[model samples]
Target chain A: MDLLEYQGKQLFARHGVPVPRGGYAATVDEAVDVADGLGYPVVVKAQVQIGGRGKAGGIKIAQDRDECRAHAEAILGMDIRGLTVRELWIEEASDIASEYYASFVFDRAAKATLAMLSTKGGMDIEAVAEEDPSAIARLHIDPLLGFQDYHARRLCFEAGVDADVVRPVSALLAKLYEAYVAEEAMLVEVNPLIIKQDRSVAALDAKVTLDDNALFRHPENAELRNPSAEDPQEQMAKERGLTYVKLDGDIGILGNGAGLVMSTLDVVAQAGGRPANFLDAGGGSKAEAITSAVEVILSDPKVKAVLFNIFGGITRCDEVARGLITAFEQIKPQVPFVVRLDGTNDQEGRQLLADANLPNVHTAATMDEAASKVVEVARA
Target chain B: MSILVDKDTRLCVSGITGREGTFHTLNNKRYGTNVVAGVTPGKEGQDVDGIPVYNTFRKAVDEHGANTAMIFVPPRFAADSILEAADAGIKLIVAITEGIPAHDELRVYTHLKRLGDVRLVGPNCPGILSPGKANVGIIPAAFFKEGNVGVVSRSGTLTYQIGNELAQRGFGNSSIVGIGGDPVPGSSFIDIIELFENDPQTELIVMSGEIGGSAEEEAAEYIAANVSKPVVGYIAGFTAPPGKTMGHAGAIVSGSQGTAAAKAEALESKGVRVGRTPTQVADIAVEILGG
Candidate 1:
């Protein structure tokens, strides 16, 4: 889950990392109130989960309350990179000195947490990496030994960070690492980590991405999940313990595994049909879960056809057939469904579906057949 | 001449008393695996289908002479189970449990890397099947047959899609390894590819990768420089959008990288026959090893 800029700063503050004093507001009136209290010169940052907000005019400076109100009104309702600004972070403007970049992201290949530090900041890291790769100094931390003072010092020294604030920067890196581990964050980045006119270092911007799988252990972090950013059908599927992603199509897809579901979507697209959603009922899915999956698929009014391409190994096809029967009785789905059942107990499951002979129901023996069948029916 | 598990495998199943553990333990036995012992802390005097049960993994190893371990433990304790099996000197540990936290996965990966001897296959995978010799994990054995084609994948049923397609075309597998779809899988495509390269029975390798990470791109590099076997690669998720986790934690497209097209192009650049579909991949493998 990606945290908004203000939310990331709020997390950084609790971890002993220095963040510029800021207040969040959801309304233009609240924005003016916060800007007035922060004094004359303040920066009003749009709180959306996308980057390049400054270039998109979502970020502005206010010299007075009137300017603050105007900027807030302009930014709060603006759409930057397809995400609407729902909140604002107003803070006192800082005196410029120098900028640097630091971040800790997981290196999936090495299976280790990597710390990247650079002398250049306030620029897109990807552009920096592509242009001058040598500018960024990378280090992998031994997860067991953890983040140490020596590790941070070595990072700063390797990145050629200025000598004046290396000590303070190292201290902040230690705290940031602590927060990274404690919060189970996938990434914690500070772009343009600023050094004030007094040569004091503070995190000017934060991008914290938490591990959604590890959210079960951290209640506070779990609560940080932004509800507005999630698709309604996707969120409902999640609540029902089904793995789902909403896609722009009219054919609803249901499968047993993530890989197979993705493959199903690909096959659907290859058959010249757009998948309405990707839904995995999970391994050894129960009949109740399949029933729920059906309801979730039909909940989308755009869905003209539904596909059940289940290759049961541990997941029994008989149970899936039972769920479809129950869904037909309960939800009374209006659209056609093309079902394919294979693997263990497939004969019994397919027989059950054939016997039911539900209206507009069809059966396919292969994935390609199922995809083509669903697409043909939906098109008709 | 299989890479990991074969007729010689003396298997001990951890969490053997649990529902899934007992079911798959018996299933593997039915496929002719040497199920030597079971390990479930306090379930020592019990047995599943005449296989001995022990209180500790050490007992399962020392008393029954078990060499391989199949883990069916819950997600929270799955890492500790791997450590216990490793400490007991198990050669290859196949974890069938899913949803193990990323931290625990990281710790176990670090520990196993340090050990350097043990091979941990999956915490969210469908185990290994050396056709007609030994079968471990939940892969339906009927879809596979003995042949010269070595297969490795990060998917379960999708692997079956290709495996069954090959079997239907009269092409059998030397060994099919599911490396799991987690971000940090215990073994990578490179690891399994190397195994297939060294095996005498495997004349060609088929890799099915999905969107996520640079594992496939890295594997393409390794194949280009090191592998001598004919390789065919197929990637899923060409239709998946960016930033959405497609069931697998590691299967999401990150920004612009890890796309199916990029992975396919990388493999193709390295002289691999990249297949657009499972059926097409099977046909490519047949064209290489057929009459």
Candidate 2:
């Protein structure tokens, strides 16, 4: 769902936002050619999903073609937050006089589109927010009215931006809002919207996060998704159409809904074990979905034990028990299994599991007991 | 009395011709919901589950005098469906569809708020219910019993689990509302809290929250300033480390403000008892209700 900086810039360009001329390079030769085409000074940036690439030495300013190639080579295989830099973006360097920040995202508190603008940009925006909370101007945009020019101008003024820069900044904000709404973006951020010495404003760095739920409407954006960027277990889960998010822990969790998975994770931790992943087989989960979910958890080498805490409703408990039994046979997991079944034919579900007579599988009458059992096994 | 939908609440189903619509409509009817009419753009004269189908929400509302609508439309058309329900003077709209674009939801939420007095429940939520009466969306009908505790949550399954736990503890819920996980939803913690605060059957409130936004903090502030009833709160994502988002589209802890600790502290500071575990939620509710 996250777009690399260059891709975000490309999307931004479509909305009439000005971005420095750039080309994505997967090899050293391509980097040199891009630098040559752009003339002498260029910025070679590592294309990774995470931020703070500059501090990590993944971004370098090159004065010549050879320097560009060397920088590109150094960044090509570099790692940022576990994401390898398989590609580099070669962009013409701009003379930045000052850096300002602007972003448009959904604000839950207001239940509306929120625009955040600040005179202080670059570096960690969180740090700036923490240090001078008042420096950032946050605006709740009415979707029906859209982000008008006047709203943008008011935000810029509130951020204490100079009067002369308001017009251009406002125009950029309007375009950014357009891209954000039209593309169904979760986040459209222009950090360090650089002010050049010539009194021109340009988006120096762009970060975009598209809403994954809206991928069905934007096939082009969906195609841009790189499955290789995701963890193998996550990729497998996605292929199976299961909602799986890996976490840092050892207890593997399987549940029927997002809320239940989250609560199960909390309970697992409360009982003295950490959940390795949050896997929701979803409502109306069948044997295949449950089997896929179990396999995905077992696939993770870090997981020490598996927990099935299902509060089945529309999905019958007996059906989930059947799936778990079927998946246990298919997976033949070495890790311990702790099951907690409740709601809708729970008696039948418990009976089926009892009849299975599988080793290393224990059924708990309560969620707490199941969580405790999983924790005990994980610790053991 | 329930907060949103009760036994007296008449309902209409949108997208009733679709498979999902037909399926849930039948389920709703079988579950004893007062489903009066169905709306599918072109399939007006037909009937789904013996409920008359109308071409639009306006026709359904006009004919059946339906006050509530449960939408099963796909994500692409969900926004328009919500707007139509709002325009047609449907007082309560519950959108059960998931995967709606955040921007589209923003538009729908903004429009619904502007319309004023019309309550919207969710775009991705399991909808609201008054136990043993009018059940909306996909929550298990058997897990609930009529009681005094009012439950509201962002997560649907948690609501079900918590409701079941309460039922096991001999504590029945007056109503349960899933405000949903979308960042830009039609209703929020404050909306439900406001309704629960005024409901007579609801003697205690169980607020379930997760990491994301300051809705909990805002609700805490409201409860602090207004509500006099006993409030038991359980916030998820405490063990969920800072900065790691969950499956909810709106789930994100960008900073310390939205952390579980901060929310728990805020709620506790407001005199609301906070439960650290899901099982502990009912215990706190029982204590609050003097059971």
Indicate which candidate wins on lDDT: 1
Model 1: per-residue Cα lDDT over A1-380, one tens digit each = 78988889999999998899889898999998888788979999988888898999988989999999999999987988888778899998988698899999977877899999998999999999999999998899988889988899899999999998899999989989988988878899999899899988889999998877787787887777553376778778978988899999999999998888888999999999999999999889988999999999989889999999998878889999999999999988899999999877899999988898888999999888999999999989
lDDT of 1 by residue, B1-291 (tens): 988999999999998899999999999999999999999998889888799899899999889889999999988788899999999999799998888877778889999999999999987999999999999898989778899999999999888888887888888889999999888799999999999999999998999999989999999999999999999998999999998889988888888988998999999998998888787888898799883
> Which ranges of candidate 1 are over 4 A from the true structure?
A29-40, A64-66
- Pairs of residues clashing in candidate 1: none
DockQ-based class of model 1: medium
| Pairs of residues clashing in candidate 2 | B147-B172
> DockQ, in order, for the candidates?
0.67, 0.72
How closely does chain A match the true chain A in each prediction, as TM-score?
0.96, 0.94
Instruction: Indicate which candidate wins on TM-score.
Output: 2
Which candidate leads the pack in DockQ? 2
User: Least accurate stretch of 10 residues (summed lDDT) in model 1 chain B?
Assistant: B282-291
Per candidate, native contacts kept equal 0.62, 0.75
Error of 1 at B93 (Å): 1.0
